[model samples]
Target: MGYFLLSRLLSAAVVVLGVACLVFLLIHFIPGDPVEVILGEGARPADREALRQALGLDRPLLVQLSQFLQGLAQLDLGTSLYSQRPVMELLAERLPATVELALAALLVAILIAFPLGVLAAVRRGTIWDRAASAFALLGVSVPNFWLGPMLILIFSIGLGWFPVSGRAGLSSLVLPALTLGSALAAILSRMVRAALLEVLGEDYIRTAKAKGLSARRVIWWHGLRNALLPLITVLGLQLGALLGGAVITEVVFSWPGIGQLTIESIQRRDYPVVQGCVLLISLTYVAVNTLTDLIYGWADPRVRLGIGE
Candidate 1:
């Protein structure tokens, strides 16, 4: 366990470093001088030179890249060109909102997917199974951008049940969470149903059923736990992806989360904020992937022994 954990953490560190460097270069190499973007056409030549010198834009590209990397070692993402505030500070303020929305979406996915998956597996060819598949298709086929507004219209405007936008409270979070979770739930249900169907065909399931155990008991107690291995991996990885996906939903609804801030900063070409936000997101994805791999190894003994043993 110790060795595995160490290896995973090391991999995560390398991935984070590579992603940060890539993002830095992407923003750095963008066309049009950043100084021109910062200062309009009316600015004097002397002022432009002074601004370039002050921002260290006068330095060679390699030197600027080196300084940026060194600053990153200490968690300093530099200051935004537009806001003149530390990028890390802005990220700290915005991150919690994204985390909250992602959590809510995960909860929604679990609640909707698990039962439907189970029923589809148990019922097999019945109408209930068909219905589950249909719902899953809708979840996968429809894009969130389109679904988000429709949810708002149906729940907020049509039924007058929830708020259309804003992050004022729980009511406002409902539509956005539902919108984000539905797509995820659809994909997850298909996986769960497939996993469960396979597990049910195994010898242990037949033995349990032959012993006169109730169908629900056999499925929940025996089949479910064994089948959960693949589903667990999907849950771990998809939950991380959902964090990234929430940015769009958050923006559509005017939620003040990291995604919204990241978009706003990008539009203004605020280097510090853009770099900081992208770094945070990339680090999160790598860390979560590493964690999921480690968890899978721990949960399945076959994976821990390196296969040959």
Candidate 2:
């Protein structure tokens, strides 16, 4: 396990370096003048030159990259051109909101999707199963923008149950969390159902039934336990996607999360902020993926012995 973990860590470092290079090259290739964006109009040539020099834009690309890497070593990303605040500080401020929202959505998805899927699989060919299927279809079909507004209308405007937008307390979190979780739940339900169906047909399940174990215990423990391997994998991938996808829900709800900050910075072509945000999101995605790989071992003991490999 130690060797395995060390290999994973080393590989992750290589991937992070590749990601940094890709983002750096892509951003520089984008057509724009950071100095002009920062200095504003009617500035004299000398002033523009000074600003460019101050921001390190006047340096050669290699020199700039070296300096950036050096700063990265010291955990410095420079201050934002617009906000004049450290990139790390801004990220630290906004990280909690995004973490809270993403975690809420994931919890809701698991709480709802797993049981629905299990029920559908256990009660196959019945109305309950059909209902779960239909729910999945509807979830995959609806656009988040439309769903968000409908939620705002019914829950916030019509029923007076929740706020229309903005994150404040528990009441404010519901609509956005549901808005994000609903679609995820739908997808998860389908995945879970399929996983359960496959696991149910295995020889061990038949033996358990033949052994006269209670149906509930057989399905919930024997069946669900084995079925969870695939669900765990998908959960990691989907959670990563959800982190990026929340940009829309965050914007609509006026939630002060990293996604909103990314959009605003992109519009103004704020390079440092954009880079920091993208890097953070990438780090989150890869970290989740690493966790997923680790989960396979816990979910199934044979995973370490090349059984799942």
Candidate 3:
């Protein structure tokens, strides 16, 4: 187990390093110049050059990349080109909102998915199963971009049940959370149903049933407990996905999260901010996946040998 964890951590570090280098190289290749954006086209040549020099934009690309990597090693994300604020500070301001939205979406997915999945699997051929299946299909089909606007139109504009945009309170969180979570719920429901159905057919489950245990006990304890291994894997990975998906959702809702910050930085050619945001997201995604692998090993010790290799 220790060897498995150490290997996973090393691999995670390597992935993060690759992501950092890739983001730095790609952002530099973008067409617009941050200096040009910061100083209007009509600005004097000396003025533009001075501003560029001050922002370290005049340095060679390799020099800048080296400096950026060095800063990262010390947990310094550098200052934003446009804002003149520390990139890490800006990220700190926005990280919580993104985290809140992502966790809320995860909660929404779990609430909707579990019972529906269990019912559908338990009553395999009935209308309940059909309804659950249809819901999952529809959820998967609807894209967040469209669903976000339609939800705003219905719940925020027409009925006036929720705020249209921005984070204010719990009521303001509902629409964005729903928009982000609906698809996850659909996918998760199907996974749960499938996992549970397979577990239900196991010999141990049949033995539990034959022992005259209550149906609820047989399903929830015997069947569902075993089914949880796969469910945990999905939930862990999807939590990371929810953060990435929040980019689009945040834009639609005008929510003040890192995703929105990232979009604004891109539009303004704020390279440091954009790079910081992507690095943060990539780090988070890698970290969540690594933790998921560790949890998988913990849940089933037999899996640790495979994981360590």
Candidate 4:
């Protein structure tokens, strides 16, 4: 267990470091200068030069990279080029909305996916299974860009059941959450159905039936638990996908989250904020994968034991 944990931690650290450096370098290399964006084209050359010097854009790329990494070591994310606010502070302000949306979406996925998946797996070729399969296909087929606006048009504009945009309250969150979660739910439902179906055919399932455990108990307790490994794996990986989708979903709904912030930063050529957002997203992805590995060890003892041995 110790070894497994240590290895995962080390790998996570390496990944985070690589992502931070890569994002910084890539942002710097991108066309259009932050200084140019901050200072208008009509600005005097002397003024632009002074502003560039003040922002440290005049410094060598290696020096800037060094400073950025050093600041990261102390959890400082630097100041936003456009806002002149601490990157960390800006992220702190917006993080909650993104987290709320992501969690809500995850909940929506799990709630909708699990039961439907189990039912589909159990019923196999029945109409219930077909219906679930059809829903999954539809969910996967729809992209967030289209789904988000269509949802807003129908539910918010047409029916007036929900707010059109912004993070006002629960009602406001519903549309974006559904838009972000639908694809995940679709993918997960299929995964769950397949995993459970495979587990159901195992020898132990037949033994559990022979032992006269109630059908629900045998399926939910034994079959589902065994099926969870793959399901959890998908959930962890899909979390990153959720974050990526949040970018589009938040934009469509005008949600005040880091996803929107990232887009805005990019358009404004705010390198610090953009770098911070990407780094934050990358760190989150690594952390979730690590947590998933830990869950794997807990859910299946063989995982940890095998690593330890």
Candidate 5:
């Protein structure tokens, strides 16, 4: 167990380092001048030069990279080009909103997907199964970019059920969460149905049924529990995607989260903030996958033994 955890942690660290390097290089190589964006095109050359020097943008690329990495080693994310605030402070302020949005979206997906998936699997060829399958297809087919606006138009503009945008209260979260979770729910429902169907055919499941356990007990306790292994894999992977997807949802709904911050920073050519945001997101993805691996060991003793070896 210790060996497995250590190896996973080491791999995660390497992935994060690679992500940081790639994000830094790509953001710098992008055709934009932070100084120009900050001072505007009409600014005097001398003023631009002074600002560039002050921000250390005048330094060589390698020097800047080294400095950035050094700061990272010390747990410092550097200062934002535009706000002049520490990147860590900015992340601290914005991370909660993104976390809230991600968790809410996951909850919505699970609540909708699990039951529908189980029902679809159990009913197989019934009309209810067909309807559930259709719902999954629609969810997967509709992109969040389109879904978000349509939702705003119907629920907020026409029906006046929820606020159009911004985060004021729980009411504000409803639209964004729905928009973000809909596709995930769709994908997850299909996975659930498939995994449950497979588990239902296993020898142990037949034994449980033959032992006179009620159908519901056999399906829920025996079937669903075994089915969870695959479901967990899907959920873990999708949770990472949810964070990346939040960027688009945040923009559409004007949510004050890390995604929104990242977009704003990119527009301003704020390197530190953008780097910080990407690094944080990458770290989160790695962390979630690692946790998923640990859960795999916990869910199946065979997996635990394999890890221990």
Candidate 6:
């Protein structure tokens, strides 16, 4: 286990380094001058030159890249060009909201998907299975950008059950969470149904039923436990995706999370903040995938042996 963990951590570090270099180059190469954006077009050339020099934008690209990489080595994300605030501090402030939204969304997805999936698998070709399949189809078909507004219209404007936007309290979290979770639930439900159906056909499941165990025990204990291996994988991957996908939902709802911050920084050409946000998101993706690999070892001992290799 220790060896597996070390290997995963080392791989995660490499992925993060690659993401950092890629994001830095991409942001720099994009056709926009942060200095000019900060100082209006009508500003004097002297003012622009001074501002550019102050921000070190006047330096050669290689020099700037070297400095940025050095700052990263020292755990310094640098200051934002527009706000003059430390990029790390800004990210620290915004990260919790994004996390909260993602976790809440995950919880919603599991609650809706799990039972529906199990029931569909148990019922097989019944009406319940068909209905669950249809629901999954609808959930996947509706994109978050459109679903977010529709949710706001129905729940916030029409029903007034929740706030239209902003993260004030639990009530305010509902619509955004729903919008994000709906698609995840759809995907997970299908995975769960497939996994459970396969597990139910195994010899152990039949043995449990023949042993005169109650139907619930045979299904839940013998069936769902084995079926969870694939479900766990899906959950880990989906959680990582939720963080990335939150950007669109956050924008539609004005949620003040890292996703929203990324958009704002891009508009201002705040290179430090944009890089910081992308870097943080990339690290999160790598971290989650590493954790998922660890969970694989826990779920199946055979997987642990594979990891050691």
Q: What local lDDT does model 6 show for residue 266? A: 96
Best by lDDT: 3
The C-alpha lDDT values of all candidates are 0.87, 0.86, 0.95, 0.92, 0.94, 0.93
Model 1, runs deviating above 4 Å = 32-34
Model 3: residue 207 alpha-carbon error in angstroms = 2.2
Per-residue lDDT of model 6, residues 1-309, tens digit only: 778778888999888888999999999998988888998889999999999989989999889889998999999999999999999999999999999999999999999999999999999999999999999999999999999999999999999999999999999999999999999999999999999999999998989988999999998898998889888788988999999999999999999999999999999999999999999888888888889989988778878678455
Model 1: colliding residue pairs: none
* Residues 1-309, model 4: lDDT tens digits: 888899889999999999999999999998997777888788889998999999999999999999999999999989988989999999999999999999999999999999999999999999999999999999999999999999989999999999999999899999999999999999999999999999999999999999999999998999999999888889998897687679889999999998999999999999999999999888888899999989988788889788556
lDDT of 5 by residue, 29-65 (tens): 9899999999999999999999999999999999999
Please identify which of the two predictions, 2 or 3, would achieve the higher TM-score against the true structure: 3
CA lDDT for candidate 5: 0.94
Which has the higher TM-score value, candidate number 4 or candidate number 5? 5
Q: What are the per-residue Cα lDDT tens digits for candidate 2 across 1-309?
A: 665666777888888778876776777778878777777777899999988888778889888777776777688876787888999999999999998999999988889999999899988889999999999999889877788999999989999999988888999998888888888999999998899999999999999999999999999999998888888898999899888888888888888999999888877777888888888888899889888877766566676556645
Q: Is 2 or 4 the stronger prediction by lDDT?
A: 4
What is residue 150's positional error in candidate 1, in angstroms? 1.4
Q: On residues 116-177, what C-alpha lDDT tens digit does candidate 1 reach at each position?
A: 99999989999999999999999999988899999888888899999888889899888888
State every prediction's TM-score relative to the real structure: 0.94, 0.91, 0.97, 0.95, 0.96, 0.96
Query: Which is the better candidate, 2 or 5, if ranked by lDDT?
Result: 5
Least lDDT summed over 10 consecutive residues: which range in candidate 5? 300-309
Clashes of 5: 0
lDDT of 1: 0.87
